[model samples]
Target: MDISAEKLKQLRLERGLSQDLLAKQSGLSLRTIQRLEQAGGGSPESLLALSASLNVSPQALRHSSVPTISHWSFAQRSVQLSALLLLLALLLALVSLASHGQFSIYLDLVSLLFLLLFVPGVTLVAAGPMGLIMSIINLSLLWQHATGSLAERRFLQQLYQLQYRLCYGSALVLSLLGLVSVFYHSPHLSTASLQGALGVLCLGWLYAACAAELLLRPVLFKLNVSIQAEQHTLAN
Candidate 1:
């Protein structure tokens, strides 16, 4: 917010320190420290790093410039807020597309797109496609998610993330099999091959879904993980 803080932010960014990395080293939450940089008020620990590592003063860090998002930025919360907005945009876009569209061959493309959006792709796998009404409900739930606190939001995020991943995964597998089926020769189509492909695909989707749910057990409450979040217990 201030000139000095802006400069400090710029310097921090130039050093290539992530908010998480900085927080890990400085004993603070990534969010809180990020808020400081945005507010042009980094922690004393951050200041120490800046002064010692960057040869700047705490006063200078405060009055330097706006603490930016990266090693080059320390000026404004550009990197931090931009990342937040980026994820928000990506999630909203996915939700929007999934909510009010037909599951055509195009959706396979969308699923592939979703896979590319996240790292270590193909996390969630869903077999049943959501109908129009279900899509509305899902989008509505996602929009309402914005009003909650961090923990609440994290849960919703986990839910949607897993949901999309599953859908994408299912779509991916189905698309591949569909490709395989179309590739070779099949004038009338054999019962055995069809059954085998269909069976294997179903089992794969089911297994992926269970595994994703189990892996993200904390964010996703299966059988109500008994998390004392807010004031009530949650059920997945």
Candidate 2:
């Protein structure tokens, strides 16, 4: 069975299977798989195993050319950016909760509503069941709060806060999973360095998101104030 390094790599990538996953499926050692993909030489047994695991003929694997990496499309970039933003917002809210021991329930509600209504609502949309459950809980809480009982209001506030945390946590986890899936299928990165690089990418996205928000907050506040002033003047 003749195979070239480029051909093996291309075939593996075409299947969108990670080296570790391919190794697991083929019952081959990870190192052996990696070596064969990088160096092009493998035993007949290894070649047959890989071809079977890849769902390709051994001859096809031997003849396939290296595939060219394509630039990320607009939709892909938009999804990545949305996921990054969600991650950043979640991290910031989490930090606030940890440092302050409490957070604004109204703010949390507004943020959750924003996430559910806009800004990559895919995860929140997929979480429709959870949202419905939370809505029922919220209605019950609102009824209690409307009775003018301090204890009920406090309890409802706490529940709302908890719901906020849960929703944000769920969204963050879903976003991270999507990102991992994208990266796992990417052809540009080597399998060995992919995990470490993914970790760094996560950190970098979080940092950039936080930094951008911080830098823009003042300008955003001024813009809001100006808009409010103009609206008041028009009303007069």
Using lDDT, give the best candidate's number.
2
Compose the digit string of candidate 2's lDDT tens values, residues 1-236: 34677878888888899999999999999998888787665667887898899888887766454222133234334544565576687769878886786543213342344444442243235446564454345453211212323444344444444444444454466457657765767787677667644554344334333433432222223233333433342232
Candidate 1 lDDT, 1-236, residue by residue in tens: 13244664577688787767666765667775666666654434556654665665556655433222243224223433544475576557667776777323123343344334432332223322333223224344312212334464455555556554655466466657655864464555587866654554444444344334433332233112212222231110
Candidate 1 runs further than 4 Å off:
1-119, 122-184, 217-219, 222-228, 231-236
What's model 2's lDDT at 169?
53
Give candidate 2 regions above 4 Å deviation. 63-236
lDDT score, residue 166, model 1? 57
Q: Using Cα atoms with residue i matched to residue i, what is each candidate's TM-score against the true structure?
A: 0.27, 0.26
Candidate 2 at 186: error in angstroms? 91
